[model samples]
Target: MARLGPLLGALVKIRWRTLLGRGSAEITGEVLMLLAAGLMAERFLQYLPEFPVVWVWVGLAVCWLGMSRGPEGVPGQFPLTRGDRMVVRTVELAVNPLSWILVFVTGRISGWGLCLILLAGVEWPTWRRGKRVSARPSRWPALLRKDLRAAVRLFDTALAGVIVLMFVAYAVREANLAVEAAWIVPVVVALSNSTIALNAFGTDNGTGFDRYLLLPLTGREILWSKTVSLVVLVGGQLGLVALAASWRLGWEMGLVVGVEGLSLLFLLAGWGAWVSVWVPFALKAYRFADGGSVWAGLVAFALCLGPGMAAARGDWWVRLLVLWVAGAGCWVMLGVAGRRLERGRERIRERLP
Candidate 1:
């Protein structure tokens, strides 16, 4: 136990440094976001009186588990010779029983049992195959396809999509909530999309970082490809939100929100590209760093959402003006980020570890 104490402490410190870097503001913002999410979850539960709270808890747990990027190469850097497989399995075994307890306590054993069965059915084949698979050379189509697949596979990405839908549904059910939906929907979508953009290179998990350099594509091409992929991926989700919002808030309001959502996405993607080059960090499954791009996103969201909501109040010219300005700004930022990415490729490579 004495020896394990220091080992655990070392592990925590390493994770903190890797994910959060030295940003106090980032850390604080993440904590506040977490508290806000908890409050929102409580309110969400209140809205669903018929549903079991346990299901929400279970869903949250699953989403949290899915958010994990899994054990990356950092664990390999440690003196521990056992490898990450053992470490990961040990942690899983320790926490999995808690899931079972939640299921049993809720008296939804059968439902939870089926969920476990379905999960096993989906995961078993992948686990059985246990082989290292390499990606094909980076072409735009292939890269986009890969990013889309990765996005779908991630629990948080899917959760974000669901949350957007939930917000839309809530707006549809509660007319009074429409005002909140305008800015809320766009902010949520922007932050969701920014996850990949800001942590662009981190997705390589240290293994593929070097292979990117070897690829035939230029840095600008690589950056643009990722940007386009994320825009499409998150844009599709935003479209659904728009449809739902439109159903409740009317076409004009929906159109305005939709335009604002897309604009926020573009702004975030551009900002993400710049940060990816200038302040890259390794991706982790769970950490405060997950909210790394959020502070900037919130600032942009405020700037865009205020004028957007006002314009939505009934000013066609204002809406058009805001869209044009935001769109132009997005393009300028993208151009600047691409140039920075090209110039800083060497530094980015050096930082990846």
Candidate 2:
């Protein structure tokens, strides 16, 4: 038992570094997750009625999602001794997001907590592996399906956006506080996604952008495909979040958040097309972003940050105005990106090839 403490601490440190290495945007997303967890914990303690089933599942969800979502290297690359396994499991349980819920519930219902702990304790690799794969082709084909597949290439980034959306929903639900700053969520999402959004061409290990060239689409058409992909990525997460928030926060908040998210999506998709043409790079999952041009960062700020900051003090209607203006910009930018993509086809091939 005494020897196990040191081993557990060492593995925990390794896990932390691996997570931190994913770069600032990714880290910020994680920190926000903890914050959302903490906020919801307060809400749960105060208002929600207790059901044993609810308590058990909520507790189990904390560690299960953590173990699944967080990358922990290739399974069994290095042997884990008995003590090593014990330590690794302990640390994973300890640092999981929304961990406060698990602790408080355990104190209230020790039996359920123990069972949940035992269930989550067993070895399970990353979450994506546990996902149930679809058997049939999608009913929706063409660009929608294409976009959906591209978004899956780095679904972790989309999950980060989900965290942001959930956090914003809960934050607004807090009593005696204002929800005037809905744009913050979309802004954070845009910046967090900069790793991919900035380099749209490199979504799937330098291969995601290849499918576009296969089609006889023009540059505007190519950019439109990527934009649809972004829409699916952001929109799907937002939908799930709104459903969850609707359960606790009112449905009104969901509508408000939808407006906010759509506003930013227009700006993001429009400007992201330009970034893809002018400042593209390849993306690798679960690692620090290696390459991006200055234009990428500047475009993100000008497109997302500017509108977000302007609407900080106003309510959802202000964001709607920003949405209308961004829609116009999106139209114009799409044209510009298409023209550039058409002219620079060979050059883009040289760089991306």
- Highest lDDT, which number? 1
- Which pairs of residues collide in model 1? 68-285, 69-285
Q: What TM-score should be assigned to candidate 1?
A: 0.70
Tens digit per residue, CA lDDT, model 2, 294-339: 6667767777775566556556667677878888888898899889
Give candidate 1's error at residue 75 in angstroms.
14
Tens digits of per-residue lDDT, candidate 1, 39-150, equal 6655555554344444454555455443433434444455664444455434442344334443454346336565664344333433555577666775477778867766
Each candidate's lDDT (Cα)?
Answer: 0.61, 0.59
TM-score of 2: 0.59
Candidate 2: where are CA atoms >4 Å away?
A: 1-159, 165-173, 238-257, 288-290, 314-321, 349-353
Model 2 gets an lDDT of 0.59
Model 2 poorest 10 in a row by lDDT? 44-53
